[model samples]
Target: MSPTLQNEALQSRAEALGQSLPPLLAEAEMLAATLMLGEHGRRRAGSGDEFWQYRAAHQGDPARAIDWRRSARSDGHFIREREWQAAQSVTLWVDPAKSMAFSGGRERPPKGDRARLLALALAVLLLRGGERVGLAGLAQPRSGRSQIVRLAARLAGEPEAGDYGAPETAGMVGHGRAVFVSDFLGPIEPVEAALSRAADRGVRGALCQILDPAEEEFPFDGRVIFESMSGSMRHETQQAGELRSRYLARLAERKDRLSELARAVGWQFSTFHTGAPAQSALLWLYRALEGGR
Candidate 1:
């Protein structure tokens, strides 16, 4: 998109998302730009199929890696050949369940909206990068611009109200990279199990855990009412100071468990609370991935 259109797009997005969107979009854009420059995926270098310069050979270099045609035209000393394939396919999975729509901490957008903007922003990056990007709910097909528009419309219309594991994922398998976005407020173990399932199937992926800062720190200062996004759980809070330490411990456990599960399943996991400007986490991750982190 033109820089003007891009800014307008982001502004439109932020407006739709209430107030907590600018930071999220900024983060996602930074991530998108960094991801394109990263080594993990085939990047679009101007023309869709134009050849780019090569790097030095590395260990276990495959015979296919050698560009014989190029070598025939130059001093052939390297055996490791890196061909720029078409832009790598990227599939983004977003959880639209009501739980993901939870909103807190000084009128932040609901988690669902944040996740949508996040996904859309990434889609903008991917599409702009000439990558064939698809957007899917838990179990949906490879989406196109129309599908993404539908997703955006869904966000604009209902905001939230959906199931987490819709069994649609069984049919979709991204050959390259899959990005999973969710709040993960539900029983965390099941989500890990799902990730494990994906890993066993050879699906390389990353997870961006979108969270409301309220979940990280029990910010309730007085008699506060707490409700679950799932609509089946609720807790009345009259005292947070007494529970702060315990809550912090549990939160720490949650973080550790998420990290462990991600490591165990071979997926990169990141946690982002609502209070943070999304750009930092997204850029940090983009830089890490670019650096092969």
Candidate 2:
């Protein structure tokens, strides 16, 4: 093809990619705005010049550590603590497996859409608070408003060909934080391996499980044909309702196993349904990450 043709083709592709971004970005910004409305950014304790809070002096308190003015106003000695001003790097992984595209109905967004929105919204909050955010194994951690565009583009990239998605652990920085958002209907072994590897690298984070309401409530009754989102696995059942007990049991077991895995790795885990408001998950994620640090 000629140079002009090549440039035109590239421009066309770029425009097509840009088209998918605004809705996700706008919705994410709106969702993030609701949380940012009446709240100040997260604050935690560490070594810094700015004062965080005052607490009673501990057993090993030195004379110099006590705040004379604050102590005089109080019954006991108080030590001034400073807020942690150092910024943190947060890497996020939103599962791109075809499974995440599943939606039980037309009323709500797909699991994949919800996952991306939450990821982007969380990134907006993190960036606003002066932290570096990136997509795990895809984008390196960087802080700036422009990074959100890159993240949204990457999040909208091609989906992996599989019935489920696995967390990507490569290229993770040691002692950094990460967030893995997925339906996690895949084999537990991959999830275990990813978390274990992250733990070895001292990468603590959270697991936000996004699922469709239909998947959670097994509402199918009569004859039903169930197939993986990738169409790689299929099963025909005469009575889908009968399998609800088994399905629910397995789901419970998976949740328990995930919780256990998270605990073992010094991480946190939470579940979000597509049917619920996105703010709840974003808030939990924001707090969970802040607390983890």
Most accurate candidate by lDDT:
2
lDDT of candidate 2 over 154-216, digit per residue (tens): 887778888788899866778988999999988899999999999998899999999999999
The lDDT values for all models are 0.60, 0.90
- Please state the error at residue 88 of candidate 2 in Å: 0.8
The 10-residue segment of model 2 with minimum total lDDT is 36-45
lDDT of model 1 at residue 88?
Answer: 46
Best by TM-score: 2
Clashing pairs for predicted structure model 2, backbone only: none
Go through the candidates in order and give the clash count of each: 5, 0
